[model samples]
Target: MILTVTLNAALDITYRVDALRPQTTHRVAGVAERPGGKGVNVARVLHALGEPVLATGLAGGATGARIRRLLAGGGVREAFVPIGGESRRTLVVAAGDDEPTGFWEPGPRVTADEWDAFLGRYRELLADAGVAVLSGSLPPGVPRDAYAVLVGLAADAGVATILDADGDPAYLGVRAGPDVVKPNARELSALHGIILGRSVTVGTVDGAVDAAAAIRALGARSVVASLGPDGLLAAAGERVYRAVPAEHVAGNPTGAGDAAVAGLARGARTGQPWPERLRDAVALSAAAVAAPVAGELSLEEYERQRAAVTVTELR
Candidate 1:
């Protein structure tokens, strides 16, 4: 079984309108809600792919309850610990032709007791999991080293771990020696103090490849950089593979990285070669962008993209 941990899970709310204007009241044309946060999103894709997955995290309040209900209705296994603080809700608005704008909550504070509860639960969950993923941010009151500690626990349980985090949590977690670390171009650039929304091209990709190497040297067993529409670059052991889609996809790219992480986890679980693993990751990411919402991927596009993905060994 695969285990996923969402330390800062949320109720992801999306609103679609003809146009969004400031100081104006607009009726939303459509509204969709789902269980969100990196790990939760990854678990959704994993479950959709017929993988046995258990998603665990911290949740509370009515919103948290709604999240649990949504997960249950979706048939995703969840074992989130209840918290004293209410969980967060993230809002994304898409106005016709324009880019989506997102409003995120800082999330409710989690006390020490709540953190301990999750750690104990995580330890118990590891026994049944062959792969464990720790993703997303640290909620208030939870230490930045939370992922690091979880990675260590998974190591002792003989479970391969994947870490998807940002900032200090990511920096610290990378040092704990997870089997894989998935970070996008921006996240990778942040480590080198060179983050700005740059174009995803061959030249820029080479820079990301270099950054990935630095991450691997920090104790990460492998590094996979999600390069948006350019596809993915993965390095494990002494092998590197770059997987690129045949064409660029445009749509909601919110959960693309999580989809890729799911694919990576699936490939690792089966011990597929690096090239096949990257091919799967890139195809799933493309399908995610074609979907109207996050978490769901278009199987039709996925099939095509899977065959369309071109894998090049760079090592």
Candidate 2:
């Protein structure tokens, strides 16, 4: 089974308006909500793919309850440890064809006892897990190196791990030697102290690969730098590969990275080659872009895009 850990899970809410004006109110045209946060989003994609997956995390209060309620019917088994603090809610407002504006709330603070409880449960789940996915930000009061701890535990349990995170958690987690680390261009730039953005150019792709190499030197067995529409750049050992989509896709790009993570984790668990894994990840990411919401992807698009993806060895 694939085990996904979302320490900072949330209820993702999207609101649609005719147009968003700074100082004015507009009537809501539509609303959509889903269980979210990086790992949870990954789990959703895996479950949709008919994979045996388990989502484990810390959740509490009304928001947490709702997140679990949504997950229960989503055909994904969840084992969330109850906490005293409320979870978080992420709001995104879509206005016409313009880019969506998002508001992310800091998740509730987790107590020390709650953290310990989660660790215990995590250890048990790792026993049955083939690949353990540690993703998202650390909630307030949780250790900054929380991902590292989880990675170490997974390693001890003989389970491969894929880490998706940013900032110190990511930096520290790399040193613990996860099987693979998937970071978007922005997150990779943050770790390497370089500037990377959504509009990834050829030069930026080179920069991202360089950053991935540096990150790999820190102990990650492999580093996959997600370059948005530019696709993925992966560096493992002395080999480097690039995977690019045949065409640029535009839609809600919110959970594209999570979909990519699902593909990567699935590949790791199934022992696919690096090039194949990158191709799968890139195709899944594009499929996610065609979907209206995060965690949902057009399978037809995924199938068509998979064949269209070009994977080449860089070195």
Candidate 3:
């Protein structure tokens, strides 16, 4: 079973409008809400892939309760620690004219006692987990090394851990030696303090490959750098794999990375080869992008796209 940890869970609200004008009123054409946070998104995609997963995180207040309900409704197993503050709500306004505008509220502050309780719960869950995913940002009052500690604990339990985060948490988590780390182009650039180019066109695979190698030098066993429309580049041990999407499907792109992480974890659990893992990751990511909501993808769509995923070996 995969154990997913989300320190800052949220009720994600997404609104679609025909056009968005700053400081002007616009009627929304669609509104959808779901349990969100990077770890939750990963668990949702894993569930969609028929994997056994347990989502563990912090939750509180009525909003947190709603998040749990939503996860349950989506057939995800969850174990969230109750806290004293309310979970946050993130608003995403998808304007037809441009990229979506995201407004996020800071999550609840967790007291020290609450943090300890969560650690205890996590240790208990780790005993049964095959892989553990530590994703998303740390909430207020949580230390920067929180994910690092969790990764260590998972290591002690003999469970492979995957980390997906940004900023200090990501930096520290990598230092803790996770089994795998997934970062996008921007995040990878931030971590290594160098620009990895704006695009991975045909002429740029060499640069991308070099960048991925640098990421592996950071101590992670494997580094999977997601290149958005160009698909993904993964450096696993001594082999490098590049996967291209079967075809472009137009839709919202949120949660596609989390879906990719899920695919990679599922592939690892099944002992799949690098090429197969890349294929699964690309197919799942494309399916998630084609979905209207974040983190939710149709299994049928994944099946249709899986056969079309094209993977190439770079080394």
lDDT of 1 at 52: 96
Ranking by lDDT: 2, 1, 3
Q: Candidate 3, residues 52-98: lDDT per residue as tens digits? A: 99999999999899999999999999999999999999999987758
- Model 1, stretches more than 4 Å misplaced? 193-203
What is the full ranking by TM-score, best candidate first? 1, 2, 3
What CA root-mean-square deviation does each model show from the true structure?
2.9, 3.0, 3.1
Query: What lDDT does candidate 1 reach at residue 107?
Result: 90
lDDT (Cα, 0-100) at 102 in candidate 1: 92
- lDDT values, one for every candidate: 0.88, 0.90, 0.87
Expressed as tens digits, the lDDT of each residue in 1-315 for candidate 2 is 999999999999999999999998788999998999899999999998888999999998999999999998888899999999999999999888888898999899999999999999999999899999999999998998898999999999999999999988888898899999998877887777522223333356677777887777788999988888889999986789999999999887888999999999999999998889889999999999988666699888899999999998888
Q: 234, model 2: CA deviation in Å?
A: 0.6
- Candidate 2: stretches off by over 4 Å: 22-26, 194-203
Better of 1 and 3 by TM-score: 1
Score every model by TM-score: 0.94, 0.94, 0.91
What does candidate 1's lDDT look like per residue over 1-315, in tens digits?
Answer: 999999889999989999999999999999999999899999999999999999999999998899989999999999999998899999999888798889998898999999999999999999999999888989999998898999999999999998888878888888888999998877777644422234333347667777788788887999998889888988888888889999989887889999999999998788888898899999999999999767688778888889989999888
**Of candidates 3 and 2, the better by lDDT:** 2
Best model number under lDDT: 2
- Which 10 residues in a row give candidate 2 its minimum summed lDDT? 194-203
